[model samples]
Target: MPAASITIIFSPYHVGLRNHRVGDGPNRIRALGLIPQLEALGVTVHIDEIPPVDDFEGEIGRSFEVLRRTSLAVSKARDGNSFPFILSGNCMASVGAACGLGIKDLNFIYFDAHDDMDTPSTNENGYFDAMGLSMLAGKSWHWHTEQIPGYAPMNYKDRFLYVGLRDVNETQRKTVAEAGADVIWGDAGKAVDFPGELEKRLDKRDMSPSLVHLDLDVLDKSVGMVNGFESEGGLQEEDVMRCMSLLPKKATPVSFTMCSFNPNLGDGDKIAGIGIRAAVAFVEALIATSVVSVQQ
Candidate 1:
């Protein structure tokens, strides 16, 4: 393995949610000087911004368009052997990340407070963001998935590993169980061995490329809420770092996404700082993995 490089894809649109401030997340993260911090780690960094589309009507349509563009950008980064790190407003961008990687047998690691597995019929809030994982698994929004340039819906029934899930609904929980997806439940004040559990699962399965999706809402409120959908029982910052540290060794992390960080809802700078710390941890893990691979 050679030196690791990163391609940062900024997606500022928030069509998945009907909220006003969510769309501002990407810009806020960039404004907080994340680029310079990443560069200081001794890796080449490329920043690509997805231009906003004005013609798409409705939340679903707009989300489709934005993710389509995200797919293209991620694909380019993958082709160059540079890690794709998507900074986006909503979790649905994970679908685009999967499409861009073009790996049929990829394992998905989703870290979020919510399950994001609701289908159109089961979703009562009418939030497109809620159905992100469902769409990725080809359970809902078939029309939108087909429109994404290089996206092919994956049968991720048993390939998903969910962490920090504490705010999920009954329907979503049932769906996850029925699909046989692995989960590490979030406890209100207790810390679980997240990295150890994840490593066990990875070792049981056949080695495959992975996509790590981090939704900032998965962090406990004590860490600072980056979005409106804050949950009480969640993972601590150290737990997240631990899981990320194990990711590159347990699985080949081809792409990563840090989403749902809405800076406008809370102390903006503070929230952005927390997000930056998590991003740095992820990069450090990748760099460490690359070095080990070279030695091996």
Candidate 2:
């Protein structure tokens, strides 16, 4: 059974700027009636937004502030027994959500076109979001992560699984291999048994309720560019939903976070609609397969 209520936390900042670039995605998705749709699924909905940084902190400072705020909001929602759902412009917010879940040892099912395991030393572009997974895995950025409340890096090697990884650099590829993380490559142009693939690697006994992070760029460019980082040979909308639906069998999805969407890209409304459908599908699937109910 689903929680009696769900809290949606919106962090609408892209690289620290409010409503800028992909930062606009969170509000855009909400504007598309995501709340009503989720409520129609029979759960009370509470809304929360991460406030913008009052000062002109550098991207690093502002971004960490956003994560800190997200951590607190998600933590509050969890304390109230509400399932927390997050929408953010950058994938880094997953770390905040995980920390807020109050689980020191956690598993993650990540969907993205890129590996997101780059370190400052390895990332030539200096893209901070690229280091999200590395930070969560305790590989880089130790200085800042320690400041966030309730954060402890995990031995996330086998605990993490990657789906739709087709666009990546050699550094990212090497990191994935060295970490021994399981992956499902996207460019393999054939019908994939997503559940069968996941089941083969995931040991249910070792799993608990886990977080599901969706970087919209995991969708194929043919599905309309979800963001500037979208690549070819990605999954279709149905493929994403199918994969999400299977998660409950292996590990119940206690929380879901959708990130890295840029409404400025091709056909913003169309792309947001896909995200809306995905959110609804994820919630509905959770409801269908829910084995425990937490009343608020």
Candidate 3:
């Protein structure tokens, strides 16, 4: 592993509320020893917190503010040639992280339980988080999304990889299909080769920096529930660790993020520990990949 440094940008806000519900997950996971574990490997790790806003805006206003702050932090980290690691309450932070890394020609690898593809008109539940992937694909929320610093709607084409989908609605399924994304369903009855699928897609494209985003709810309930939205048939812990190790082999991951963890829920500490371990695994994979690159 080459000598490297990382900047961890954590947002302890869920839907713009500080330490509310899932917002606590980031701090909790960090407290669980994510930083010390990385430092043990002799990796330099810097910590940055998203500044809490004084004005009381609604969820929509606050959420975008969080994203804007996140983008700035991410850009600063990348400017220093440090890897950006985001720990946020909402998976939508991926937009800010990607934009900060410069969105032009950037590829995305998404791991989530839900499709997160509902548009404003299509989302009956009125859940803002559900529309994250849709916004990334430039399918919805044009006005608000444009407000986010460094944010531009993502170009899906062949550069998008959606994995561990098991609880998507019909509308989300249709939306994802129309985008022509490569998907690996979590509920497939047959065995899955996570690395093989990732490599196959990566082989089709020129090597470019990628953002790897993991929503903790992608883990199965049996592994310990990560949030209220967790369902029965999601990926197991071993499956997630294996995928984390293999993703860096083909994709040059410039940034990594884990979101959608609600520590207020049952067994929060257990899930936080799992998330911390996965994060450590990802950094180790990055180190190993970098060493191999240097060797060649």
Candidate 4:
């Protein structure tokens, strides 16, 4: 009943957060609830860890390695009949999965409260987790900037889209502008009606596959629960759903990531359960779209 075996990898690595909390945050978050719902929806959960951190190049190297491993795991998951697989991870783990998927000239539909666009040297601290996007774009340390070879790195070019970003640094703005990418602010008041919007927007830019990464913080801290570094001027759950509704028909193997769920949303069980349900709905919607295409 578990969708013929889906690899639900829980990345326990917390290589990014400057402020630390529970040592078993990953396990605790998982236990709060997700397994039962996913199983009931016909999904098998395969929990596992990535290769240990390396010391030579510090955390960044380990981070890159994990991305590559995630890619490998994803590839294996996709073998034979392609069932919708799920991956739950932290910040840098998201980076690894992006690398794992060979997205050339990729368009990133990044939904988060922050830009995650800070270059390493530019960051006040030498934290790889904080600078995942910058390094992916080949914009950071010469060594760490390398993405999986031949894979399209996460450049801010025509390939980037930021939704629900109400807080950011100046460097991120300049970088985003340099790439001429589009950024959508998540104001609760403004309605997102821009004239057949998404199509008009995508039609105006490059035509390629996309990587959609949704950081849990995009939702108001009240609705989704337990996010990393909560911010003001947040997006409502409906707004987030509206954004998800715009996923196109032709985007190949669309990759979606739900990241940095801090497990602090009030009534942990309800919060985590609903969060998992929302995530699963997104995936289920993706598969249903495939069915719609077949019938049409």
Candidate 5:
């Protein structure tokens, strides 16, 4: 089989919050030598950095602008037949990833500690990052998303699976239930069969290309809190790896995004190291799955 090739797109703008250091996540990951590690695995890696947009309007404006740029970069990578591995500061980047793939019908697997299902009316903190999944499901933010070229809201709510969610409020939970989206609560131990459960869910849905969205906060604080919003009783490194390994078998992963790694909030080196290892494991797993699929 041919060697697995991947394009790494870095988005360094954390426009979700004002005056936050989450924007520095991509640089820190690069500085820690993620590319060399992937190369060591015998994978062809291409790096594309998305320039930060300087929007004078506000956080929301800046967020949309960054998503647009990321969408374009991801689209180009897909057009070239390179698997896009997006390393972004905010989870909202998922919008761009979905748009770039240009799939009208796709499954979404979101791994995060928080539900990220808040709408403008439901969000008390007024944080844009908190409403990423909501926007992706076409639950809100229609006016802003219309401005982004090639952006289409995903109306198929039942096609999404929310994993490792433990930080959700009553409002978010109600919204998620209303959307009929599946949820797998976070487990500190190996009590849940993550891969098997996920496979079962996918089997029930239509076979379509899927996208995996990983928020570093899905990991337990002990493993390394990559962002400020760290919740307890999260998945361990092995659990995360196992779940990611099983993802491709259930559905074709057209693209993936790893987001919400704020190096300034915790031990920068430690958090970055953990993130690098996780990212490498995910890519390696994808390659292995691809090879197996081809052989079959």
Candidate 6:
């Protein structure tokens, strides 16, 4: 464990949207199960929890606090010449990871069913948390991204790959199109690469350094998505796991953060748990490959 890479579980529940499900449990609580499972991966996880902050303004305020703590913790750890971090968080928690994992720049592989590019201005809800990806992409955000100092101008071309888009508002679709983003849409796109296509996608990014964020609802409701909007044409656990196995190791240190998982979705929890377990398997594959390649 001393030499194994660290998996920082940055769980900021303040902006935590309890995933409402029928005959099921809450997402945040269900997420508790992920901790022990992740520990089995031979990585240390830092589960950072902030109370529950509901709206945009409140979420933004507390996020700053969480970000500061995460930064301090990471800085005190080591020279950080180690592998890129494996992070997990709620909503805007990814933003904190984006800010904290500022090692030689990082490309964000944002996997969600929704485009999440709506700005405060374009948002029908006028909410900020819903518009996190927009802020992270340096598009436009409520105040969460705009007001945050020392972390904007967020890398675009050299960073950011989008996957599993199904229910996107026109604005977010437009944002992705205009951003020259490399997106994997529908099953066709998801099926494009095995281990090779994903490798190229991540490595192709000018910066190469990157991280992966998985929004659990990216799966179809049939599969039992607890929280977040689920869309049709989402990837099955096998396909998603296959893609994960293909990611380029030399590109950057990686972390897999999944959100919007509602425990209450009766079966959704099973589906959510399986999706995450599949992901853990993918990481195990990476570890095996890393070890095997070294021994050879």
- Report the number of the highest-TM-score candidate: 2
Best by lDDT: 2
User: Residue by residue across 32-61, what tens digits does model 6's lDDT show?
Assistant: 465566567765544433334344355456
Clashing pairs in 1: none
Count of clashes, each model:
0, 0, 0, 4, 0, 12
lDDT of all predictions: 0.80, 0.81, 0.80, 0.56, 0.77, 0.55
lDDT of 1 by residue, 1-296 (tens): 54347889988778843334777887888888899898887778888888767778777778888889999999887677678999988788988988888888888888888888899899988778898878877888898798887777786656888888888778878988987778888877777677777788888885457788999888887878678788777877787878777777777777889988778765678877777888887787778777322112
lDDT for model 5 comes to 0.77
Query: 270, model 1: CA deviation in Å?
Result: 2.2
Top-down lDDT ranking: 2, 3, 1, 5, 4, 6
Candidate 4 lDDT tens digits, 78-168:
4522332334445655565666655566567777787776775667645446677766666665464354543455656666767777666
True lDDT of residue 248, candidate 2 = 71
- At residue 111, candidate 6 shows an lDDT of 68
lDDT: the better of candidates 2 and 3: 2
Ranking by TM-score: 2, 3, 1, 5, 4, 6
lDDT of 3 at 286: 85
lDDT of 6: 0.55
Tens-place lDDT per residue, model 5, 1-296, is 32246889888778744325777887788899999998777777888887656644778788888777778888888777678889888888888888878888878888888888888889988768998777777778888887666777776467778878878788878887887778887765546655566677777875457788988888877777578788776777777777777777667778889888888876777777777887777777777776322112
Q: Which regions in candidate 2 have their CA more than 4 angstroms from the true location?
A: 188-196, 199-206, 291-296
- Candidate 2 lDDT, 1-296, residue by residue in tens: 35667889988888889988888998889999999998887767898888888584799898888888888998998888788899998889998998888786677888888888888888877789888877877788898888777788867666778888889877778888898777877774665555566676565345566888989998888888677877877888888877766777668777789988889876788889889988887777777776324233
RMSD in angstroms, candidate 5? Answer: 3.2
Model 4 superposed RMSD (Cα): 4.7
TM-scores for candidates 1 onward, in order: 0.92, 0.93, 0.92, 0.77, 0.89, 0.75
